[model samples]
Target: MDALEARVHRQLERMRELADRMAAVRVRETSADGVVTAVVDGNGALVDLELSDGVAELSPTDFEQTLVSTAASAARRAFAERGALVTGFNEEAAEDG
Candidate 1:
């Protein structure tokens, strides 16, 4: 292959590797009171949630607020991680170019 073709192939391989790494990313966050915990994927999609028995004591409104906030925090963390991965990939590609 020509130099340009080789470079393109390398970049495509890097992108696929990035996609695989991103797919494996996950972030977990827990509420301050430890009543709720959430896990989110790289795309900020909730993958799992956990609630402690302490949640039983919370009012419906409080419980809802806690769950939502915890999940949001987890999603935010996941997004941040994803951004870091992308940033690193871009930096590597720039160096290669």
Candidate 2:
């Protein structure tokens, strides 16, 4: 209702925009054998996967599970990094405040 609240709201909106941009990013993780790699979006959506014959040779169930887990892990890391960026932005805002 007041000016200060309005200012805070604007800042939060800016932060959200930054978060959205950060979430749109992409990151990758590779399997131990380097035979499989997973790509995930900033929000942890599995976008693409690269698997070599070595990886394909594995039993289908286990190979698929590993790929899925690795993709999830990559997504988790991307989120963690995004969180860190948000924390950094908040810290900067606090200092400015």
Candidate 1: regions farther than 4 A off: none
Highest-scoring model, TM-score: 1
Colliding pairs, model 2 = none
**Model 2, span 13-73: residue lDDT tens:** 8778887879677889998877779998878888898988797578989898888788888
For candidate 1, the clash count comes to 0
Clashes of 2: 0
My TM-score estimates for the predictions, one after another, are 0.93, 0.75
Return the lDDT, model 2, position 72.
82
Model 2 Cα shift for residue 83 (angstroms): 0.6
Tens digit of per-residue lDDT, candidate 1, span 1-97: 6999999999999999999999999999999999999998998888998999999899999999999999999888888888999999999999997
Best by lDDT: 1
The segments of candidate 2 whose C-alpha lies over 4 angstroms from its true place after superposition are: 1-17
